[model samples]
Target chain A: MSTDRLRDVLRNSTEHVDMVELTDAALKQSRQITVRRATVGATLAVVLLAGGVFGAANFWPKTPGDGVNVADSGSPSASAPVEPGPSTAEGGGEVTVPPRIDGAFLYVTENNGLISWKPGSSPKTLIADHKGGEDMIFETANVSPDGRSVAYNTTSGKLRLRDLATGKARDLMDVYEGNFCGTPAWTPDGRILITPNTEGKSGLFNPVTNKYTELSFTVNGCQPRVVKQGGVLMVYFIDGSVSHLRGIELESGKVVVDVPNTAGSRRATDMSAAMVTADGKVRFTMRTTTLNGTLGDGLRGFGGDSLFELRDGKLVDLDFDDRTMGAAYQGGDGLMVLRQKIDGKYEVSIWDMHQGGGFDTEDEPASLKDALPLGYTY
Target chain B: MPDIAAEFTEFARTHTPSLLRAAFLITGDQHLAEDLVQTALARTHRAWRRIEEGNAPAYTRKIMYHQQISWWRRRKVNEQLSETIADTPSRGDSAEDVALQLTVRKALLQLSKTQRAVVILRFFEDRDVAETAEILGCAQGTVKTHTFRALGHLRKALPELADAMKGNV
Candidate 1:
């Protein structure tokens, strides 16, 4: 029909509509939405206020005579027997005591030492500078799953654990004589440390019994990330140009799940990191490209480097882009600890995979201050 | 002090019928149309102070158009369209007009979302090409192409409507 006739038909068709009733209904809905938004805003404000108060109460120093000791290890010569009450400093200033680092914390390697950081507190250097020589590196340290102990390959090729509470370091094993290459992956129960040994083999070192057992499987040039369930390990290896994720049953050295050519491209897949979930599913971040061109070059070109999870026995894209640099499975909650590049700085964030599967950064991303360039674990 | 709620309510009271008609044309479902209008109005109410008094209808229309497209893109399964047309009169309406309306509605649904939006804006809303392009966030040439293709689809779907247009011209 003609444009004018079409307009007339559309306009006339609405003649029988009850405009007043629709308006009332719409107004009510609008008001309801407004009320809901206001309520959410108020609730958020109250929650933030409560959180601030709670954080201050928990982290703030107690007043003088509050029966708290402020110990300074560096000032050992001034080790006076601390009374039950808080004492004033020699300079007459109220002594401020550092709060104990509790809950899950991060152990980051600095130049040659390790720094421990909790969410609300400042980072504390647990290990002093012991820079690596030509054949030994002291920075490849792994924090236990419980965040209690830190195990590192020393410059002298000794595997040592530093008790965070006692600030003492003790040798666990000597997996290598020089140049320890592989990182220590801690099991879920914190009982075993899976260390990569010489000659493309892996060894399980128990700190309690000082017993070391070598595995039969060879994971040459690959990092073994352990899953929480069933002693399964997600071993990432690159053979020639193709990358593979092999799920190995730790006890029997049996390969259960094998995914060859992770990106399903003939091109080389350069896998950055992989983490296994509690349910034994593997999630990895990698970049794949053909010989000459970028990622979007081949037939069935998946976009640039993104996160993918092995779901239902196939690699499924998680829609995350290259901004995510590293991810660690946050215990059993289906939430992952993600290190993302935001505004040119690598910031730590928590991504919820269970609820709609995206990074929920409404809160400010945690800063990776005083952290080593590469090593971080959750 | 002017009551924002009262001002918004009065605006809705005067404009709900036309807005509902536009939403129905966009979504082709009565319940969905009501939902679109409500969502648009709620957004408009939230931004009532920032929007100029004379531009409330345009602002609400923009929200409804964009929201409809977003919902269409996000939903995996297409919802079944209701067979009963609420706007079509039952007793007094001529059967020919009802049939023609039904055919036009069906033809409109067959067009892609952008094409359907172009058709409704160009013909029913009487928007110029440039205005429709700006509203649809597309180039003027793209709007013209969509309008041409939509008209071609409608003419093919309803040859009788093409003849009626020719006779009217």
Candidate 2:
């Protein structure tokens, strides 16, 4: 009877629940999840093959009159197989730094400090004892559109810009107190879109002139992605119980495209970072959690990330194989995906959204076996 | 043979009431309880084919607990103290029963999320320490510790319910 009393109390607590409404909401969310899974499975065969032709060609040493060298300084040939770097134990291994991929230098945080790594060379420490002493620099640090500077926020709330050439760092603004979103996004025109301030004021900040232009409209989102042709800024933000992707026209400041997540399904689709194509196609990385014992034993903790592209206002999977691709950058004519191969190698392949073709393999000067893609030379 | 959707709908309709009751006790908020149940069912629907022949309700409850633990922590501001327990003449409950239920509900919410889950599993669901630990993906020792601490808090908060809670402690 005592046990019944407790059970009755618990049952009475839910007496007000509307069963029909709850069932309908659950069904709708289930359909969305099904759609997401099917979309991902369909795009599996649409693989970016090995050629590295379009944007990756720029990483190789160009013959005279080729005029293609951007971040090129390594001796690795385009076709020759360079030996893999000496391996280390899983967590304590040596960092395999990559050669300049597509003229872009990667800035990563190791145990020592923040290091700027180029192809065929060792990682040079840019800042010793940096404020944010974690590998999370890869999440917040973005290479400028020109690849001349890297902008990263410190744990102390200081947004600092480190020049790749001079290695000098300076404070842009103190945004630590505000609800500063992660990863300060760079506009195509080379200005950084600072996450909105506490007052909901966002602006385009020109790092060179140290000038800040208030955006025509106030937008709220984290991980803002912009296309090169720049009509709208794709912003990802969670409002209350749902996550949304709203395309705000840069000029009018009006929301042009609004993709709201289903109610009561926040964890089902966690859009951490997104990439916007010139034609307005958006691909985002969704982080899903594993259902501990129920799902599987191997997938106990974080249920790794899945790449999804927003098509016709629905999220389709963008992953082709087991290899996980990082944030894509606008290359010459298409988007360049930096894919980590299953055999412990890195491939910088150009994916033409319209055309399907084979990718050419080019050997990176040093293996970026443990590096996170921050930004690239565009 | 019903398709996945049709089968899932029947499953959702049948199990949603118990899921809602458990979720309401776990979250102590009607809106969050509803959301928790929906989210759990959504995930259950994803692995429906895999778990359809297996224990679907257990899988759903596991998802509900895990999701609620991760979610309510982030949305701490929205966690409302549950309303007073509704009086039911059909249950033959008196005024003291209502007060005791209200006290138990409020006291349950006061414990940490993990402790609250442990208490609910051990007492309400009648799960042993091993089962509670397995459901929570924690060690049996953790469940025992949480169980001891939770019952201590409950007995301290509701002295009237102390005799009923004796065996568990």
Top lDDT: which candidate number? 1
Ten contiguous residues with the weakest lDDT in model 1 chain B = B70-79
**Model 1 error, position A42 (Å):** 20
CA lDDT, every prediction? 0.52, 0.52
lDDT of 2 at B155: 77
Each candidate's TM vs. the true structure? 0.46, 0.42
Off by over 4 Å in 2: A1-101, A105-107, A110-139, A178-180, A198-200, A216-218, A228-241, A261-280, A288-304, A319-321, A331-334, A344-368, B1-169
Candidate 2 per-residue C-alpha lDDT over A1-378 given as tens digits, one digit per residue, 9 for 90 to 100: 365555566555446545545777987776754443334323321211122222232212244322111111112234322211212222212322122122334435443244444433455655553443522344466655545566766656656677655666676765544233545665543344454443447655544345555666655554565543243443443332234555675545667666653222222234434556446566554443332212111101111245456677655554332223444343212344444331123444333332322122222334355554443342
Model 1 interface DockQ: 0.17
For each predicted model, how many residue pairs clash, with residues at least 3 apart or on different chains? Answer: 0, 10
Name the best candidate (by DockQ): 1
Q: Fraction of reference contacts reproduced per prediction?
A: 0.30, 0.31
**Against the hidden true structure, what lDDT does model 1 obtain?**
0.52
Give me the TM-scores of chain B across the candidates: 0.86, 0.86
- Enumerate the candidates' DockQ scores in order: 0.17, 0.14
lDDT of 2: 0.52
Cα deviation of B154, candidate 2, in Å: 53
